[model samples]
Target: MRAFDLAASAKAAAQAAVDAAAPDLVALSHRLHAHPELGFAEERACGWLGEQLTEHGFTVTAGVGELPTAFVAERGEGPLVLGICAEYDALPGIGHACGHNVIASAAVTAALALGAVADDLGVTVRVLGTPAEENGGGKVLMLERGVFAGVHAAMMVHPSPRERLDPTCLARAQLHVEYDGRAAHASACPEDGVNAADALTVAQVAIGLLRQHMTPDQRVHGITTTGGQVPNVIPEHTEADYYVRAATLAGVTDLEERVRDCFRAGAVATRSRLTLSSTSPAYSEFRHDPGLLAAYERNALVAGREFPTVTAEDDRQAGSTDMANVSLAIPSIQPLVSIDSGDVGLHQAEFAAYAARPAADRALLEGGLAMAWTCVDAALDEGLRARLLAGATAGG
Candidate 1:
């Protein structure tokens, strides 16, 4: 039988610790929301989060995995190492629209709470300052470079419009396509110009048509970053960024090849030079640990967070994240913590406005506490701990 008494005691201690740090945690969330930074450029957010972790007695490593903005904070010397991921990178143009501010603060809160009883529970808590979830795949790079070498399991809570125990996280790849062609005045010597913009248009049209034959779960979306220098001049160079997503990494890779053909077709038709490159490593599908997810669901429910009934058809929360990459390597979970921004979805300017509100603050605290409590439960459950430890050893 599990040591219910010890778990209860440790949970109380964790709750008290989080409650004591509530004001500071909420402030941190608001501060990050106020100063939104883009992926791989989160200098201020990284420094501020590191400072908070340092103040709470974690050994903070400023840079890890060759990423200047990525860091790892650790506390305790227990046998089972638990990783709590913190994502502070904001979306470009939308600014904090994805609510990474809440993610970072909640991670800090979980780290502090777990730190309070780490020794008692025989659990070493690790807080990973993961950057570039919005663009560069920071966690994917870090995982490849051994930043998560000793972590037995990992988890993080992402802010959303509704509470979900396990959100649909797809495997995704970012592709940057560039086209180069001869430039000429629109009216003067127009025949001498090779329109790069036309190449881009052809590629887009192909992609649009390709969508019809694609599987229901597959997604292909992109934006034109550059079209032309001036309307009066034929475009000499054009560039676009695209994301191809599917149910699995292998599936995405296959889909990526087909997508590349579309871009190549554009070049063939317009006789423009085309260059294709990946901006970051492809993210993998999430594999959530059932035990951890169940523990978190119970804890979240007890914290007064409700998961409204919704069928998969009605749920539009399917998205891509670097956290999914981490989940593939370690037993992990990324639960969706609701900010109560009804009808205001993620990546919207209106959602950014709600990220710093009272509702979001409440979700931050509740999510953190649930994560901490789940950690306590994991530490107290000897069977789960042994399994995680065994997996870590085997993985090593």
Candidate 2:
């Protein structure tokens, strides 16, 4: 079959499959949205996804990485292994504000749609249940455990304020800082005790000052998790959580050193001892395969969606993801699908409401069909596949 004919056939098959399953997919997305789990604690979400895939005839493997929330479901046999990644974990306190429910539903829909045409397309479809993307770096951990060792390509659609292809994601590192000091009576022996809270304040000031000298792409943000016990007593200890980001991994590493030095300066000025530790896996900048991304954009346009061109002005708002880590290792694309996010952006209550709206529901189907069609194109289009492989190998 001609490439266009194959794309149309694959799209038709994907649409049929998605239309037949739309109700259940939307319901699952809503259910997950209602009961959000954080990070590696997504037991119920993971179980439900596994059950859904198994019911659809995919061979399901649960708990692949000593993590209760991680699993893999596969169907068909072929040399090309196409992975559709699912992230079901929600943000702490904010629930599905990140629209992970949409992510899970879209991935499941794509895998099932691809599974329906796997035999004819000569491709193997693997749906990965990657948990804790908001915190634990489940994909990074799974990659380390060889979960994605043989995968040829990976794809996942994220819900955002707008649609874009191969958008740049920053490299990020998270840190937890603790300050130790001596406690004393506030009104009596205040001079005898060192204040941990003072150390944290000093650090914040230092970080704020350091921002003036950093690049425009660099980001430094943090919060104090602890301050004190009582008004009358000087706190003996305090803690703060921070995230440092840069345009690339190498830049982030260099920036991290400077941030650490600021924290040390805070500790020294406040006469408090400080300890800094990483809270999760460091996120790398996305290494987009232009060849694959172009295919994705084509498929998306065919699905009645248009991708907006990113410009310099819009660069400040992009967030980091473990998918960036996957991109560094293999061919990958992380495109955003608009879902009526309204004026509210990610990590907010209003955005969570949009995750279940009709617009989001439509995105689930369109995004899934687009992804399935892209997979079919990749497997059947020798020229595209060769270009993708060459790009990935050269980058490595």
- Highest TM-score against the true fold, candidate: 1
Worst 10 residues of 1 by lDDT: 387-396
User: RMSD in angstroms, candidate 2?
Assistant: 1.7
TM-score of every candidate relative to the true structure: 0.97, 0.96
Residues 184-247 of candidate 2 have per-residue lDDT tens digits of 9999989989999999888888889998899988999988889998999998899989999999
Q: After superposition, how far is residue 176 of candidate 2 from its true place, in Å?
A: 0.5
Stretches of candidate 2 off by over 4 Å are 1-7, 309-311, 387-396
RMSD (CA, Å), candidate 1 to true, equals: 1.9
lDDT at 308 for candidate 1?
83
Instruction: Tell me the tens digit of each residue's lDDT in model 1 across 282-396.
Output: 9998888898998999998987789887777434457899998888789999999889998999899999998999999999999999999999888887777888888742233
Can you give the lDDT of residue 16 in candidate 2?
93
In candidate 1, residue 388 scores what lDDT? 88
